[model samples]
Target: MNAAPSVRAVIARHCRELLADPLLHGDPTLRDIAAQCHQPLRVLLVGNVSTGKSTLLNALIAGPLAATAFEETTSSVTWYHGPEPADPVLPDPGHRSVTTDFPLAGRVMLGDSPGLNTLSDNPRETLRMLGGSDLTGAAAAFVCVLVGGRVDQWAEGLEELAAFSAGPFDLVGNIVAVMAKVDEVDEAVEDIERRVSGDTTATFRFAAVNQLMAAAARTGAVDDRIVATLDRLRTLPVMHGRSAPAWDRLAEEVGTALPPGHLKALEQVVGAPAWLPALVAATAGMTTTGAVAEQFERMSRIRSLEAVLSDLADDSDLFTSTAAVLRLRRLAARLKPRPAALVRARLADLTATMHTSGLHRRAAARLVRHTDVGSGLTEHERAAAQALLRWPDAGADGGGTSDRATAAEVDVGAVLARWTAYEADPFRDSRSREVAALVIETARHRLRTTTRQEES
Candidate 1:
């Protein structure tokens, strides 16, 4: 079988066909979407004051391109893309654009906005990028929301920002909540994940990251001087807390080996005195710079954050498609009766035929990613749902999709029944019911496909 056309290609084809219909030819909204659908997967990093949003952006790009400081340094919206601008002709003076070389530059566009809930005009600048501006629609396809020290306060701000950008579709799928500066807090990463996931007010997935260390690891901040200093410090006793005196003692013990000004620099690189001991322990026998950087990378937990971001990025096309369809619907609702009917019919046909099993499963997974959304689901029911969404073609035993195409005949009927009932329940929130509806469709399709395979 031939490969399916990309989501953008499909949308472009439909746009051509619909524009020929004369009714949607000059529609402003349709024209805007046609122009913007080609934009790269736009990911915006947003948070309250000093949540390490800039630091995280620097880490992601593997450079210190974004300015980082203890205070609010990012005053304006800075957009980073590869050498080529996603939309060069667009006139949006509110943002500062930076073109650079980065791994994901060609595939994704990264935006770093000013912190929200600040004393100055920072919040307004950020709000504009989040779709409060008069120029265009929402700037980002997905938002990486950062939460630091005070979770409740940051979450409150996030809730308000989420409300402002709210659309007909639930924005939960378009969000990824990041608990930044996890090392600064006393709570374990797992505990932090559980705590954030338990918050019913937020519906996005969660990740715990140490942005400083992650940047250090990615940017090669751990040099030979730092490694030698760590090696010298390792000769002495292990330090306990992050108190100033303990660090002073360690510096004094190393004496002439660690110079007066170098001690402060070492502290700056390693983040905290507590991390010195852990780094010494992590690189007990290591001597090379690469070895030390690898250890620091592992301790940074940046990989976990990258994985979460990668999952969202992989579904960029689907998210863009969904947004475009929603825009078309909203536009259709505003048109005259005859024009609106034509647009609606074309949209309905495109949506019904455009989505594939993989896209459908991904959409379903996003809906139920946080377990709270599927609270009423049984353990077995949830497992089956995971299997279907994650590895639909794999056997019940579990393996890569390429390894085998064993029919996942387990719990299909039960999953269909339960999710169908959940979708019909009026007491559930619209978002949960929407999730149930997607899962139900996926289950019904899977059951039919499995039966056909069995017969063959």
Candidate 2:
């Protein structure tokens, strides 16, 4: 579906901001990058080793772009799309491959990545990359493919996938559990499917055991054992939602709860909260329909902004560049008037849209609307708007001094001096610290510029 006008406006605004960003100016392909941002669907295939992940990748692409083998073959995260065949293997610090191709369902771009359970020592890192990839901002759905096996194995895989899928970086209402290889199970798959579906509260899509068996028959790679496992998987209901709580409950019931070492391992690899075990249980017990719906909305907005920014940054022209800046400035102004409330309202509106149009379009629309500079005040409105922006937290009763006092006072000169000291050793400490210093300096510079402009 095409994005609404407001959505388009928000995206345009973000494009403007990204173009204005000093860091993104070097690249010449910004315009192409921006266009890619507008596509509707970007589905990703992610799962454990030998779980028909490659086969699924093949099925999605309908081609042999992803290498499939008996043994774990993926050495790094490989991205697959469509049409173009350019292999620019740039070094990505985050261990991700950026590709532009894949079928377009409206504006969506489908993505295929390396299997999560590969033999590499960096399997954890691979999963991290999958979870952290910019695809999170670009994706409309995540199809998690898995084979049916012993309950224990299935449980373990689900737990691992869940841990990787949590937090701010998660897909928005975009997760689907695909049970492949269902033809081998002796019993009816419906019973198992129903039971598991009840346990997870997330939507489960089932593929009959025969579907994979037929594909295997054609390929001759289908082992009887693997087929049987696939049958079991078919009979198994697709488990959805957070697996941590279910795993934790099972552990507590068996009195074999995760040990401290295992817990620490999960924390380090997954970066979940220390109380994640409890949180998972709580999330599982609570109805997640509302939460999932909300997440979809938030994701849509984020993606929309990403697309807009990509476009604005890539296509540099005088009007486009100026438009981008004005858009963000207007956004900042809107945010300043009742910053918290505006943010909340925008978030809510975006979330509401997710249930109908998937995530990306809604997100695109949100980005356009939120970022549109023209939506803010005209010149006549600037004085009042600027006053509100300057002291957003001011109380109705006494003025905004109390609120301003509560805000953290930034010392830009001190921050800049510290940054200069660290210039010789940039790798020391966290990059976030460095970025914070830069932001402080920028804010100070902007403030001074504004003061001077006002005086003149």
Candidate 3:
């Protein structure tokens, strides 16, 4: 027998069937939903005022789509659609949407939300978006920006937001807490990570990033012109200071190499002079724009953020499918009897199709991250399960030859035996047993695939 179809394929197939079905045909909302099934995963960026939400959004999409400044800039949620366009409106005027040529358009789209903890009513806008029940025009994942050393203060707020952002089933994969502008903080990223390591309520992964550095590197702000300015600054004796030189004194020293207009622009691009000496020292001999950008990118610590995004993107299908299913279920509730019945029928078929693969992946993620459920397993077992959960290209239709080659080496029988026994344990909690059964199905699929390959 053939392997089960991927969640996306199943959704797409059903979408076609729905459009052709007499009960659902000509429904604009259903058409919109059909189109969204094929679009990239929508990931929203949100945080407190001036926490670098816009800067991080620009960095992620490699464009200055959202306005950024010291004061509150973004007043509403703006969805940055990928190369292809989908529904722009979120059924609310507070939200705005635009399309761009971001290289990762097919894999992920991004949304920039107004900051929280502000004096103005901006916080309410963000809260309203998060509070909505309908997944229509909703983000599948979220990157919550927080300033360094403020994790403790915002821990409670973050937990509340996570409840709404992360889906009913997902725990860790759907949300990420990012400490933006970490360069300004005295403490290191590792220090912050260790600080929050014990916070059980914050289920998402943590990353500390210098949004300015990442934005500069990504937006090509660190070009040869900036390098020349840096080189000129290095020659001036006054530039080497324990504290940054005053703006007036530095302007005099700069003289003609950097005119007043150019100097101010440079200030905006590279940030304060306190970190320029470090940048000059880091890129000591680099001469080209690409070389400078490379050095700056390394200094940015942006790769850590990128790696997190890459892992999230690898599981895009899971998020997309989950969001789509939830969206359809909710849509069905309010529809008329005929269309509602058809939608319910289609949703059931979709669920039965993806039960083993898509649903099980979500269950495994939840089981691994749940403190109580995870603790029930041995350390070795937990680690193995996590490794398998994060294992790249575990989806049915997609992995490369290397992925299959690696899978061929796994002791599938041993994996099946262990998880199967865990599922059958009478002492296990009903919740744990249910999740374990899902995990066992995942293992069984792997065993079957491995067996077929070996037979071939």
Number of clashes recorded per candidate: 0, 33, 0
Question: TM-score for all predictions?
Answer: 0.75, 0.39, 0.78
- Which has the better TM-score: candidate 2, or candidate 3? 3
lDDT of 2 by residue, 109-224 (tens): 34455567545674654454344432222333456666662233454545444444422212123344565443333334556456555555232222322222222222333233
Off by over 4 Å in 1: 1-32, 82-107, 118-123, 134-137, 141-148, 160-171, 238-254, 325-362, 373-440, 446-456
What lDDT, from 0 to 1, does candidate 2 have?
0.36
| Candidate number achieving the greatest TM-score relative to the actual structure | 3
Displacement of residue 133 (Cα, Å) in model 3 is 4.5
Q: List the lowest-lDDT window of 10 residues for candidate 3.
A: 399-408
Q: Point out the higher-scoring one by TM-score: 1 or 3.
A: 3
Per-residue C-alpha lDDT of model 1 across residues 1-456, encoded as one tens digit per residue: 123455545665666667767776755556556654566666778877788889988888889899989898999877787777644323245667777777677656778878886789777877665653332243535455565434565566566655544343454545667877766676667787777766547555567877787788778887887777777777775453443235677767777976566666567766656456667777888898788878877887878867665555655655566666656666677779988888788777775773444555555555665446677777666656655564442321113234222235457788788877777777988767766777777777777877898999
User: By descending TM-score, how would the candidates be arranged?
Assistant: 3, 1, 2
Would you give me the overall lDDT of model 3?
A: 0.68
Q: Rate the local accuracy (lDDT) of all candidates.
A: 0.65, 0.36, 0.68
lDDT of 1: 0.65
* Strongest candidate by lDDT: 3
